[model samples]
Target: MTRLIKYAFLMSAAIALTACNETLEDIAPKAERQLPSRVVQTMKAKGMSKTSPVMMRIFKEEGKLEVWKAKQNGRYDVIASYDICKWSGQLGPKFTEGDRQAPEGFYTVRPGQMNPKSSYYLAFNIGFPNAYDQANGRTGKHLMVHGACSSAGCYSMTDEQISEIYAFARDSFKGGQREFQVQAFPFRMTAENMARYRNDPNYDFWKMLKVGYDHFELTKVPPKVDVCGKRYVFNSEPANGGKFSPAASCPPMSQPESLLTAYKQHQAKYDFAFNAALKKQSSSKQSETIAGHSEARLVADWSKRRARGEKVSRLPPNIPSPTAVAEAPEAAPTPAVAATASAYTAEPASRLQTALEAVAGEQQEETTTAATETPAAGTVPSPAPRPNTSPERTASVPAPEAGSQGTSLRRRIQNLFSR
Candidate 1:
């Protein structure tokens, strides 16, 4: 009886831990463990090993997550590009807990970070709040690139995507790779994008990130990341042979002169392109502003035409001037009010009497037409525009005044033509 009890206890423990790892029937590990045929074929074609080291890069604005694998030459090549299903927050780094921000920086992912039986299908923490983030006093936790297409301060992907990505990491580990790198950015660090975003509040931080970006572009290898004096310094080691401290002053360091020379050449070309991009953008904004003002002026004329029940522009214009409706031969309330007023204000006293007569005729015509109309069922007819009474202001067809009266008159007389 004592021996049986011990066997039962051991069996219970196995069942309890089953979900954390594979079951007995899962020993083959082919479908779940091996890379897919296409990917394997790609590896062979690219001269990469079956289980080489992997690196990942993310672009939040572009919603792309790229997996890169090391080739035999110690350089990296693109293996896969997955579309991120969701990532929260704007184009900036996380500031505190619950900011819902997917962080941006260089991060390391060790073996312990992988989660196979995740509630989100599978996941791995991207290791946010790295040395630089810490030195700057940023805070957050459990930022992951996970499946289930759900994101809350995490980078999320579909279940299928995470499965493949997880396979890459797993196989790399099986081949004795210890850790991988993740470089996250707001967008592709292009010269044009840099020029466009030069004035953003986060530009200084992004400039720091570009050092690593430039390194990879030059060498096709992930840069060695270290933080010192609250900044990221790539591929440089302290001459004094001390470990880097996130918050301490950087020691004297040695750097590769060849890499520096390549970077300088790259920067010079980038500078030229960036300046050209800025000029193009500046010119674009000026043209839009000019067009916007012209469009604004079109609205006034369009409103005027609608009030008088005349056909105007189908849309606002690049220029505002006398509308076709204003020049149309006839509408109940003709633009004669504006025209007559303009003529009277400029001509002699004899013309004032004639202009007043034209204005009176126009007002009478509008009033008579409105009074004769019948409103639809379940509706009362609009009250007719009042008849001209005072000679000093015989009729006031509100000419774009600023109050509610202006609002009522400037808006179109709906269904006026059908009436």
Candidate 2:
């Protein structure tokens, strides 16, 4: 009887241990994920640490996302550049709940917003519909920069790329930085691009963004962002100790005299550059205009282009391009052609050449782009094609008053500070 009881007890204990083992969860050790060694070496070389505060900038048109880390001097330096895997929507601010538009503006990310166990791998919310957006009555939720090469009104990055990015943010938070800033723009706010996009419906909004952009360009530091009168105000203080109200009229604002002087100097230079860019764009458009060309002449030119190895329309200008199976659909541009185009990408490209590149998929050898220009970000290379980046059922967003009121008020402030 004693032996039987002992055997029964042993069997029960064995069964209990097996049940416990089966019920235990298997978890991914994500929080402790470390930064890549190469990035660590780069930080060391750049006089930075893993714990330094970080900022991010995204250029939609350029398809670039840059990580800038603060150095000992408090100046930020570009530490990494990653091509956005995908971002949905047109090049504008998101307005509605289901627009599928990746937003463009400054956003903040706090520790609580980071999700290590994200369904899409790791992810972080870029607090959208901010004060300015709210003032303008915009609505959206859960916009994120996350892993998984997918986008649905979010900025998607590759798993490997996001691992490094997440590590950077995690390390910064660990070092006591409260939050980080993300500056998302349609493209690099360079004068040339500004001139190119001047006629766009979003110009006024872009102009407002430029003030904050210019502040950072001139100061090498993130501007203090505030929303007032339903617009973004950068690096300014209340003149009479009043507060800024997003909907109501703005209080009188002021800036440091020295900063104003610097801005005046900067603005003078930018104005000159902007005018030149505008003139160039106008001239290029005029030269490329095909509105008045005779069909015969267009056909003749088209023939010559086809002879020059250009993929051209069978019919004349304004006619639909060749869709009928004429020549096996020209089997995905040859490697040689792609290599040639990429090799000369560091050179400047004109609007016409850019159009041709688009038609030829930027993988063709023949193009007359521009003289010379640097990639938008340091060490950035030509952008790779991203999937699911096409705009979907996009609705027209109402232009914000920031383009007008903000412009006039910003100039008024500039004028005020100059004195």
Candidate 3:
């Protein structure tokens, strides 16, 4: 009986230990059941295996997630590219909590970071607030790439897409890769695009990101990433086998001479092309401004006349009826139109339209107020003039008599037209 009890206790303890040691996939089994056949086929096509190493790259602007797998030839080949269903925030790195900005940087995901029982289907944390982020004093948490097609500040893909991406990471981990890298970028770091946004506040940061981007582009290998001097440095070694510290001054470092030469040549070629593209973009913009100037002046004159209650020959054709404009299918931009469009499309047009509408609304409101307040013709009374409530209009319209709210409103409308 004593021997029997001891054996039973030992068995129970062994079982418990094994259960505790079970992996995420072992416990969840979803990836095991659904991913094996597809993963095997994909690996076979890529000349890889289930255990092959993997890396991911995400482009928020283009909404793409690409997975690359190591092949027998020791080169990484793109195994799959998934369309991101949705991602939150604008074209910059997340700075603080609740910023809703999906992070843009190099991250590493380890086995423990995988969440098989995620509310957003299977998910993996992208390891935000990395060394570079930390060095810069940026803060955020729980940034993930997951399924659900919705996000606050995460990269959300369809359930099917996440399944495959999750499987790739899982297999890589099982194949003895302890971690995989994820490179997130605002957009493709193309020279033409960079040149167009050169004046933007984020240009310097984007330029930094392009260093890593260029490294990968040149070598087709994942760059060795480290942080020093509060910025990311890639593919460099300390001058004499020294260790790197993220927040400290960068020690003298060296890169392969061949790589240095290749990078310089690449930069020279792109710089020339970028300058050419910039000249074209600038010339196009100047022509557009010149063409629009006359129309803008006409619109301003019309707005002033309408504000004064003067009869106008016609309204601007571009100023569509609110309902018609709302219902109209936006005309598909032709190639010519697209070529001339701003790098950030439709922004200038949208802003101008919004300002115009606001001015028109204010003028209408003032006109109604004036008509209601006009006293009986015979009554002579002086009331102190109302101040112009709209300060934005003051720039274009001269101040009228104290009580001339209608004139003030009209002036504001004219100002918007000028804009």
Candidate 4:
């Protein structure tokens, strides 16, 4: 009787364990179908397997998304480029929850962040309001690079395109790439491009982003990014061998000497070309002034109208259909051009541009604000203090001052003018 009782207990425990395992499996997202043949072929051509680690770079102005795969040689190569079907807001970093601006910054994606069973076909969170965004008191949620080819404040790709992109990320994760970097930029960080927009209010911010951009360009490896003094600092180890603190003053640091030398040389060449480009552009056209109510003011006005029960006349911008996009030849990878002057591509005539024009026509009395204003030199303010006891930090950092909350919102709106 004792032997029989022991056998029954062991059998019951085994059944319970099996049931628990099954329950876990049931909750997991279903395995996706095999990668498309084209994607497979492209991976092979680029000397990458399905499991190769990847990095992505997005350019808002160019409407392009580039997938770079790590090669056997330990360098990343551009494996594919897809046109962004749609993106919202303008060419600037997103600040507020309802602003409808897709973000522009460095982000990371981990395996658990993937949503294989997504309403938008498939999706991956872009991990917005990152350390830098949080330190600056930016706010938003559910910012994603996803399928559906439509967006309110996300990077939208065609369903087909996203499937391929998603598969690359999924396989990379499976191959033990714990996280991959996503670098989103307002525009290609080229010397000529920078020179053309040098007077834009966001020029300083773009210059800062260019530092990371240059790092990748020189080494074909994503720079290790950290934040300090409320700005991004890349690819250096703290002199005292301590962990970097985003809101703290950056300690003395050093980078590999060869990498530093290469970067300096690249910058020298870029500066020479930038000067020539600036001179040529200045001679050719008077600076083209953007004549319109900035997107922020229009959004604010739209909100007011809605609250008052007025019918809004305009609709959100429409994205091009997949068929329409397929007919156009793929945009060639932008080549590094010499210092000789070349004309920048004119901004496309899209619904967003038309809306800006309409708003300008109506709000002629509105004061024009620069895209974003630069803080006075040598005025790096310390971040507001917070309790260090919490293991899980809050997404929203405390405002520097009670009154500064309003000031921060105004700055965000002003920054939208650059878009």
Candidate 5:
């Protein structure tokens, strides 16, 4: 009976082992499976590896780069966020080349900026003096990010560290996202950062760039840089290869026609509104003097126009002579009986009339109030005088004139309105 029981136990154990192998088949790795061809094509276009979708982010100041993807509910599930084994310089806007400062702007990674054989693990350069930079007279070059724990102005990730970042970028870019923007800010572009170094030596330049940078952070697209001179000029459109493309080196020449086109369009809208309002005002009366009733009516009409977002082409053509609106006249009850007329003194009735007339020009009120407000920071108020109606000033805000290679904002506005 004992021998039979031992034989029975051994058979039962063998049967249990075979059943476990079948149940674990789903967890086993597939050695022969391959990625679909469509995925392969996309990976090639975005310069990604064949294994996964690219999804990554980098914060240079914090020395962290992360990879993540969305969960079923659309929240990000981080695959990784790691500390840099090596990095260089404090975070700030790199102005001149070789300032040993990491740039604070939007950038991307390209195959060219990347070096597979870089002594560090992998590497790429943050190309500065981009088209936008050149238009603003920003000069800089050769800002790089690399691997193997080494840095000058570049970010160095260990070979293993960057592999994850590279994989994420490659996969994300390949997944139908044309361009991924990398925002590198000085620690953070917080109110604290601005206050801490409001008087730093580089404050002015940083502040100026901050305007454009903030706009980009908010809008994701670059702000229109308005360089003013005889002719307003602008930088070229951002190139596709992040910071390191040859496209950065050969910024497209500014085409006056294109810029003028945009200006003309904006102007046409303004002109239409101005003409309509002027016609309405003219129809009120042909008299040189305006009445109090007419003044109140005009203000109501202007309020309506403002509600609709219409800009006045010009300030109510400076009242050649200003006037005040007439006040309600008081009257006494009819005289009960005819009384002897009393002698009346004839004071300077004309002077009183002149003063009363000055009160009737309602349009002047808005102009007077606007004049008293403080000018925006960094802007010098233009001398008070007849509003500048010069065709150039009236047509568009004047900006720096572009050389053969630069485009001017003024030109764009002109072109837009002219059309």
Candidate 6:
């Protein structure tokens, strides 16, 4: 009976051990459910589609939008290009939201403005007049990319194309921009990116802005913006479509300064450059001519160009090589003095004379010291000084003024006393 009890205990202990092992196994991820361990596996899961993604590229130079078909692993082929808006006002930063002006900063394309059947034609909301604007105390609303060649302050793509673009963005968002990069730039920020402008009474504000622009320039990521004291702290976090909120400390936009002012400032420069280019083109027959001058001749030339189907643009000439540019020859180094010159020989003799003089002076000083030590000529030595001759204390003496005789007298006295 005791043996039977022992066997039963052994069996119970074995079963408990097995149960613990099974519990651990259950907690571990199953081999089938594990995330793919390789990039290829992830790629396979995210299937590639042949259908081109709709993309919009805004050219600030022409104030137009270039609709593109961004095929996977393919170049962005232009479907159509259309002038959407003109520079409405000044070129300054949008200080507050709801300024009724389009923003120049890089913003992500998001959902919320995809409408197929709208009265003003097909449109997509730019998600503008955003919270930043409202927080900054800006007013205005309903900024959309709509149809009709008119705008209060919105990009108006053609009615037919906007629908296609909208559909494409919707689908692509569902897909991804790794297949496309739909981007928009403002008033050709390229050259204007360099053009000069005065510190908009809000120079400091723009400096803060430059922080955000610099980040975007480097990372190509829209900066996470934070606002304090009506100034922007760009790249503060919430740097993309994520579950992040603007900081609670963000102050309200009491600044009456128009965000459009930044645009207006920027526009002046762009308009200047653009108009200058236009004027140059109009005035100069030096512009490239394909065997024609008159408007009729140009039209005929254009028709010939169309027949040949050659693309034409008034692009600037290629920059010249460094070698092509003339540079002044470097001046020869000032001629070095010849070692055989008398100046060099005299230099050593003078140095030797100085050394000999120094030695002679030292000898003379020694002789004078000896003379003082031995006692003045013809003077008898005083009776042998007392053995314990301690000097009497004197009242404190002020230091001698700089370069005073007191200093020289002190040195002479010290020498005599030493002697």
lDDT, candidate 2, 73-147, per-residue tens: 899999999999999998989999999999999999999999988988899999998899999999999999999
- Index of the highest-lDDT prediction: 3
lDDT of 6 by residue, 1-419 (tens): 99999999867876787877743333332221221235224333444232345556565446777655543454344555666644343444344444545554333355545665566666666655454555556555556667754665666666544544555565555655433333445443343343332224534444455555544444433444555544455544332333333435543232113433544566576568756665565555353332113222322332333234344211111211122111212221112211111133333335334334443454456458756778677899887544322231111222235546446445433332221
Clash counts for all predictions: 0, 4, 2, 1, 56, 17
Q: Which is better, 4 or 5, measured by lDDT?
A: 4
Best TM-score among the predictions, by candidate number: 1
Candidate 1 all-Cα RMSD = 14.4
lDDT of 4: 0.74
Output candidate 2 Cα RMSD: 21.9
The CA lDDT at 338 in model 5 is 11
Q: Write the per-residue lDDT of candidate 4 for residues 1-419, one digit (tens) a residue.
A: 99999999867876787877743333334446456778789879878888989999999999999999998898999988999999999977888999999999899999878988888888999999899999888999999999989899999999888977888898898898999999999999887899878888878888989999999999999899999877898898888776677788878888899989999999899999998998888765543334233443433443344344444433223311222222323431112211111332224345446445544443332223211343467998556445533322122222234445455444433343433
Worst 10 residues of 6 by lDDT: 313-322
**TM-scores for every predicted model:** 0.67, 0.65, 0.65, 0.61, 0.36, 0.36
Task: Give the per-residue lDDT digits (tens) of candidate 3, residues 1-419.
Answer: 99999999867876776789953444455655346576579779879987889999999888999999899887788888889999999988989988999999999999999998899988999999899998888999999999989899999999888988998998899889999999999889998889878988889999999999999888878889999988889999999777789999999999999999999999999899999989999999996785457444544454454445544334433332322222333433234323332232334466456555666675666669878888888998678576545554445567555777667656655554555
Better of 3 and 6 by TM-score: 3
- Please report how far candidate 1 places residue 37 from its true position, in Å: 0.5
lDDT by residue for model 5 (286-321), tens: 432334344334333333333344453321321211
Which is the winner by lDDT between candidate 5 and candidate 6?
A: 5
Rank list by lDDT: 3, 1, 2, 4, 5, 6
Cα lDDT, all candidates: 0.77, 0.75, 0.79, 0.74, 0.48, 0.45
Q: Is candidate 3 or candidate 5 better by lDDT?
A: 3
